[model samples]
Target: MDGFLDGLESKMRAKTVRDIRALRSNANLLREPHSKSMGEGLFELRVRQANGIVRVFFFFFAGRRIVVLSGFVKKSQKTPRSELRRALRYKADWEERFGHGRS
Candidate 1:
C-alpha cells in the first residue's frame, strides 16, 4: 500500500487515501470499483488513479477490524493468486492465534 501510494501523483494519491478511509469506515458501503470480496473471509480494496489501479488485500480479524495483508498495482485483468493466498495465510494466522468469530 505504501509503495503504491508513493508511485501515485499527489492528487490521485489523496483520492486513493480518501477511498481507503471510506472503506475503513464502511467497507460494505463501498464496493465494486472500490471493494471486492475474494471469498473465505478475504477481501480487496481497489484504488483507481489516473495512472492505473491499485489493490490492497485484507481480511477481517477479531472484532471485525481490518488487517491488511499485502498490496500490488493491477498489472493484468486478474488479481494474482499469490496475493489471495497471502491474504488467506494472514487470515489463517490470525484465526490460529485469536480464535474465529469472537465478538
Candidate 2:
C-alpha cells in the first residue's frame, strides 16, 4: 500500500492520501462514489484524479480496524482477477498472522 501510494503522481498521491484519511474517519458510513463493497468481506476505496483512478482494497476486522490488503491504478472498467487474488492472499496471510483473538 505504501508502494502504491508512493508510485502515484504527487497530486494524485496527495488526493489518495486524503481519501484514505477520510476512509479512516468514516469507514462505516462511506458509500458509493467514494467506496464500495466487493463481496467476501472486501471493500474498495476509490480515488479518482485527472491522471487516473486508483483503488485500495480493504476489509473490516478486529472491531473498528480496517485491514488494507492491496491497491492498484485501475486501467479498465472491471478489476482484474489477479489483483483480487492478490488481495485475498494478503487478507488470508493477515488472518493467519493477526486474526487470532487479539483486538
| Top model number, TM-score | 2
Cand. 2 Cα-lDDT: 0.87
User: TM-scores for all candidates?
Assistant: 0.78, 0.92
Model 1 C-alpha RMSD vs. true structure (Å) is 2.3
Model 1: worst 10 consecutive residues (lDDT sum): 60-69
Off by over 4 Å in 2: 100-103
lDDT of 1: 0.78
Best by lDDT: 2
Model 2, 12-98: lDDT tens digits are 999988988887789999899889998877898999999999999988887778888889999999988999889888888888887
Q: Give the TM-score (vs. native) of candidate 2.
A: 0.92
Q: What's the count of clashing pairs in each model shown?
A: 0, 0
**Residue range 19-99, candidate 1, lDDT tens digits:** 767766787576786788999878888888778787877777656577777777778999889878877887888788878
Look at candidate 1 and give me any clashing residue pairs. none
lDDT of model 2 at residue 40? 76
Worst 10 residues of 2 by lDDT: 94-103
